[model samples]
Target: MENYLNALLTDVMLKEEEIGDICDKACEILLNEPNMVNVPSPVLICGDIHGQYYDLLTIFKINGTPKSRKYIFLGDYVDRGANGLECFCLLLVYKIMYPSNIFLIRGNHESKDLTKIYGFYDEVAKKYGNSRVWRYCCDVFECLINACLVNGRIFCVHGGLSPSLLDIDEINRIYRLNKLPDNHFVNDLMWSDPDELNPGFSKNSRGAGYTFGSEVTKKFLEINNLTMLVRSHQLAFTGYQMHFKEKCAVTVWSAPNYCYRCGNLASVLRVDENDITGKNFLIFKDTPQKPSSVGLPGYFL
Candidate 1:
């Protein structure tokens, strides 16, 4: 496992069979987790990677690797960038190797519906010469946990609050057996965004979920007795954005220079052990240049 991780970090490509084995192992691990997972604090919370493999590597460089620090990735691991397969595979490798230290939640882009339109599908098909690896990955995506509770106080998810979610129990009861659905609580959990302009729920421009306001966020936090809601779905020029007057909700974007053109910074939220109020925001910029192919495959370019 260490060898595989090193190879990926250095821009080396794994064989097709290796990817299949890794996906199989990841699926087995994810199947055992419930819809709402409980993770501990002293864990680093990160948002979307979107196939930016080099930037993902930079994240590790700035915040340490998963082996050294606990992490909860809020999803959108694939699609958009040039190396989605490598980015996703590296994360899966970490999850398989350190199941207890790492937690992953589903994002809207994890769905088969979105990947087909985005860049993930073509990247995999082009690299592997078949759809077998892509299919296996989709299977694993179905089992990804939707939300995580850190020390039973902080709520972590890919997107913001949902209208149908009154409590964390409702999140655990969701049946995420297929691709994300429109107009469904599961979809909202992974697709919704927080709105500061509106005072209540309003239709999202994305046409899938609602944009909740500060009142809605406050109500959700109070009802759940949660200190804060940490999520990632929207981009922040400064890498993270804090909403609600009390800093009850935050959006952390980990993909710097999103889509290789947004010129946006990225950040990760580090919560110390037994200190829910101590959120250390670590900011990072994109790599000066993309990593060289080196031992990578010919198709990497």
Candidate 2:
């Protein structure tokens, strides 16, 4: 797999410029992530796959195989996991091989600084002896950052909607053609957190990342006319949990033994929606196993 990955990585690196609209490429990956959803189709939503390669394999084994059921991976595809490149390759392969069925969204880790701080940068360096794979992935990551609209009532993102994004179309208009600047609105959209936001309304916490309050979510929904927000970022003691259960918002944490020692069960959401308006949930329990890699010192944490 290493040799194959090396070769594939080389090819991608060479063609990076030719890909045209890399951000569009990312959105293409996102929109199609839920392709398995036929008319009146069900969408299987997975969360925070933080580089747990084997656990992802286990997910395929336990859940319906990607060949059968449609899947929507809710970002955070790299970092924390031992084989960030491998996990990424698998996703890209799925997108290329099963273009219609598999999908990927940009997670917080997809950023340059985060990847350099976490395992991905080091993992690539160790595997390829250079920054080739890392560079290529950065290109791909920028493209898949955000995905949305699950069951018309629900708005899906790797994290929550930011208070700054007043209009949903404003988000849609953020085309892939523009060079995404650091600390720009697009960057905040993918990396922001909802946990540390003030209860009423406020900018995200600097240390806690971009936190959003229930009111922000509520207002966003009302303005956009959405019924729910389905996101993943925080680790729940249970595999999954509902926030403001009455408001139709839910969080699914799918990384088992999250952060390597947290004991929280990993989870995924099965939207039992027959159509856009319908929304329901089925939580998947974590498959017992230790993470392949933890916060290894000097390399990643």
Candidate 3:
């Protein structure tokens, strides 16, 4: 697997039967992916890599990996930094070596009680002393893919607008079994947030979803004919954040100096296959040293 992903990019740690055969082949490729997933335009979306594994290897060393482009990953790969299980088993070994160019959704700390109160369940029971590889990576994060849409007119998600989501086939008829749920619509598409001076919903002070606005993101992109709404749970010193006027939403945040003391600044959002309103916004920072085989102790929610 590319020398086990280059020995987990140099801080090796993957032999609990190879993370249970990479969580049984990434839960059989996230169970035939559904709960909303379409992806097309010259991809590369990314956001929140809370595990900061070398800033996820400096986002493939400034956007150019996964064999030369194509990604999605709006999710929080895992709790706090210090290689959250090697940044989620090197993104499930690049989604089992590029399953149609890798995509993954489910954020809000990929639950199971927020990785046992953040820190990926004690960094997987302190590096596999047990927890059966964190219960096969929480059954592959309950078969991920909660939202994504790209070429049909962008709408990826990690969180934001979800009053039972009115369309996108109601996010492909939800029902993402096990863990994650303290409120509906798959915990508001993984914990909503986006109130640029409230023009609609409210509540979320992290007390569980709902903060939405901008006319509820322009009425959920005019009832799903969509135009834009990419997401990533809060925190944007300059990494990313745009709302209502930027035509509804955008929040990418590839985790720069976030919990390492929120000096924030990190992003990603390439798009532009045939000009899906052509986009770009690489930005980066953080990584001035913090890898002497990281000794753990970083936290964020």
Best by TM-score: 1
Return the TM-score for each candidate structure: 0.94, 0.78, 0.34
lDDT of 3 by residue, 103-194 (tens): 88989898778898988888777765568888888888888888888888788889877777677786677567754447777778778888
lDDT of 2: 0.63
All-Cα superposition RMSD per candidate? 1.9, 6.1, 17.1
Give lDDT per model, in order.
0.85, 0.63, 0.80
* Model 1: per-residue Cα lDDT over 1-301, one tens digit each: 7888888877777887888888888988987888888888788899999988888888888888888889999999998887888888899999999888888899989978899999789888877678887887888788788998988889888988788777778877656785445677888888899887886888889988889998988888889888888999888999999886777889999999998899999998889988676368999999865643444457655
TM-score of 2: 0.78
- Kindly report which residue pairs in candidate 1 clash with one another: none
Give lDDT tens digits, candidate 2, residues 1-301: 2333344333333222322333334445554333112222477778888877666767776876556777778788888777566567666665654555655766778778899998889887765557765787787775663665665556677776665676766766566446766556566656566643365445565542367667667777888787777778777778776765355577777888775677777777776645543235444554544434332333443
Better of 2 and 3 by lDDT: 3
The predicted structure with the larger lDDT, 1 or 2, is 1
Q: Candidate order by lDDT, highest to lowest?
A: 1, 3, 2
Best by lDDT: 1
